[model samples]
Target: MLWRAISEELPGPKWAGLFAEYWPFYRKWWLKEGEPARPTYAECRRALKAHMPDLIPLYEDLCDQAGGGDLAARFLSFYCPPPYLSGCSQAVWGGKEPVMVRNYDYNTNAFDSLVLHTGWKGRRVMGTSDGLFGLVDGVNDAGLSISLTFGGRRVVGVGFGVPLILRYVLQTCETAEQAGEILARVPTHMSYNVTVLDRKRKYLTALMAPDRPAIITKAAVATNHQENVEWISHARFTATVERERYLLQRLRFHRDPEEKFINTFLKPPLYSHQFNAGFGTLYTAVYRPRKREMEHRWPGTVWHQKLDAFEEGSRNVLMPGIVA
Candidate 1:
């Protein structure tokens, strides 16, 4: 997989200028053929401003900086409703001191996606997808890691997107409980399976949506749907059953997970080969909160990044035999 990585914080205007090149393509792709239809930029902004009023100034600054006179909607693109259907498989291993590993799958046509090693003022954060504003999965300097998958449904409502909520948890919370508390408070426009992990071996999974109450699940691995799959009649992804089963079987086989064992996801079941749309396995994130380290992985090779010191730029990651 090819990905662009950004380090320094580019002011709002500067990022707007850089983002100009990719705007036209995404702006036209508001609704793909089979995707869950989303609201217009105006509708999305109205919901976001009403729910997360604090982000308005930041959104305005970015649009104002982009230098395009009629670009308020352009900057608001960050909060636009994302694909209501995406695949992700995440698991927390290590009996004594758990580790969080995840594979994020999505439609490539929907986003001008990239990895971001943000230059936040208070906490150090590294996120996958969206260079500056939002995040799909990420780990913070405080040893808290979080990731999300679409909650197999087609309901959109008055709430914030899961990415920014993930960003907020990383920015403010240090413990898994704290992260969970914040997640409990926010309402999401769509459904998502969000998991948060901390060094204390505390891993929390929240099955959330704007229309329904959040269901807390007592499990290590979280796929695309809620814990109770019997209630799922409208999920977009049908492969969740196989994906969840494969990972659980692997875990049972490997009682004590080591570095080599955790790396198996670079292959099948967890790592995806289908790249036609955006559902291909973009990157497998292996987060070791206790060690304060993370691996940006490919098929055969991996880049090691630490909370204190990290490599901050774009690079190709490849591991020969692992690219299945």
Candidate 2:
């Protein structure tokens, strides 16, 4: 259970090589014994091509470069699975550059692959995926930063996963309005809350789901559920209520500089180690899109990188585990 920092350019062999190395291990976790991941891949591929045609070529190139019969299937897993992540995200702008903080919470044993990918075609994305094709939380070179929180639910449908949709936004969008347009158009497999920050010091939180259309709001925090929708996963959704309150509390009343508010995510409520097993906070990310920079902080260390000149290297951070 560790996080790795990796970087590569697309249409290059190095990026494909990285994909080959982790695809096997990630495939094992994404498609367990007697799972329906294959069918999910089919739906995912179709949806990707239909909504985001730009991805089809990139995906095909990745598979061809990897030279694996199941490469596409492996790649699709990152974008087709059930929405099984929990976390907190908030965008703050108070007479300064916007700062977006996100803490990714997911199963430590379940595809625990975390990577901060830089020097990509258009954006620098960091996520718990095998490669740089998708994003869990990332900031683009165009000064648009985004983070996702699972909209607590169980209903799975035919739609693009939120991460891939985020990928789409980073690839083609540069403003909060454009990012919101993309988030609104793409249907998600389940539900997600995407918090976006732009260079213009504008911020927005979009609640997206397959059952309903995307909803935009001016709220600073993007948690698992919203005020209008009744979440399917009641128990998990119940927990989000407090986390949402905690994030909004910081945004509204905590009158401080950007770093101070961002640091709050590294503490309780926003950060947690799952005692019951499954998902937990992998790491906390703070992105300053205007600076074209991002900081990833774990327990004791922090890694900083810029979108234009990212340090190409890999460092491992120990993983979290459960106790009896």
Candidate 3:
């Protein structure tokens, strides 16, 4: 995977170039069910205005950058687009440094492999980019960090994609409490568990679903499944139960130092290598919200960045067969 980090204060040529590059794949996927099967441009715009009012201006700006076409505009809205799923594991480390970490497991061919640092709307936000503007996980200048995992459900409904919701959280919220409220209120088209951590070490995991109200929990660990494993085949395929139990054991039975705890994710069931299954661990991300520092780790390689001084660069990581 080629991971590129680009810093842009606003939507411009850089973002436009990304849209130009990825739009082909996105357009094909968005229209997999045909154009009429998706929401109309008017409906998409209305959904954004109603749910993520603060994002309208930015959305429009990006739409213009994406050529201002009706199809591009609706796609950028990310409102009830196609249904997607991934396997991930995330948790808050209460030991020290206000850290949150996770391994993003998903289809290698379908990822953007980009890290975006932007000062949009006067807030400095940086993280893994998805759908050009949406974020899979990221942190804001306000010392707030957020990440997500598949909620282990197969139901899809009328709501925004979780990536856009993650973008909205970092763009507007400054603390875990504030993030929880936004996670609960926003409607997700599928099931996803979003975890937020603040500078003060306060954290919560919101199990967001379209078929039901979001459940806010103080639990520190979140894997693929929610309260109970709803999709048995998916749960077993992803090893969601086993992974969750392993993380909980690490947090409860061990007194691992900060470095040791982080390393644990680099090994064993946490560091998955099932790319062919479309849920391999692409990268492990570690976030220190208080310090505004984040690291993308791939076996022996580690690239660190901070909000105070984010640099634009790129690295090619060999996945599925990484040497630790």
Error of 1 at 274 (Å): 2.1
**Two-way TM-score contest, 1 vs 3, winner:** 3
Residues 1-324 of candidate 1 have per-residue lDDT tens digits of 455665545344436554676666554553343223555567656755775555565556555665533433533544545445677788887666678888877665555456666545446777775524668888888889988987777777756768888877887779889887877777887888899999787888888887888877656778877765633543333477677887777778757556655776687767776666447776778888877777767776676777667665566555232334
State the displacement of the C-alpha of residue 7, model 3, in Å, after optimal TM-score superposition: 0.4
What stretches of model 3 exceed 4 Å from their correct place? 322-324
Task: Please report the candidate that would top lDDT against the real structure.
Answer: 3
Model 2 vs. true fold: TM: 0.86
Report the lDDT tens digits of candidate 3 across residue range 144-242. 999999999989999999999999999999989999999999899999999999998899999999999999999899999999999999999899999
Residue pairs of candidate 1 with colliding backbone atoms: 13-65, 106-278, 106-279, 107-278, 108-278, 300-319, 301-319
Query: Which stretch of 10 consecutive residues in model 1 shows the poorest summed lDDT?
Result: 27-36
**Worst-scoring 10-residue span by lDDT in model 3:** 315-324
Which number leads on TM-score?
Answer: 3
lDDT of 1 at 6: 55
Q: List the residue pairs that clash in candidate 3.
A: none
Error of 2 at 151 (Å): 0.7
TM-score of 3: 0.98
lDDT of 2 by residue, 1-324 (tens): 455566665546766666667767756655664355545556656767778877676667666776745545555535556445555445555546777778777655554354555445544554435234677877777788888887776667667667778877877788999999888888787888888898888888888888878899877776667654466555353367777778777767777677677677777777777735555677778888888788878777788877777665666765444564
Clashes of 3: 0
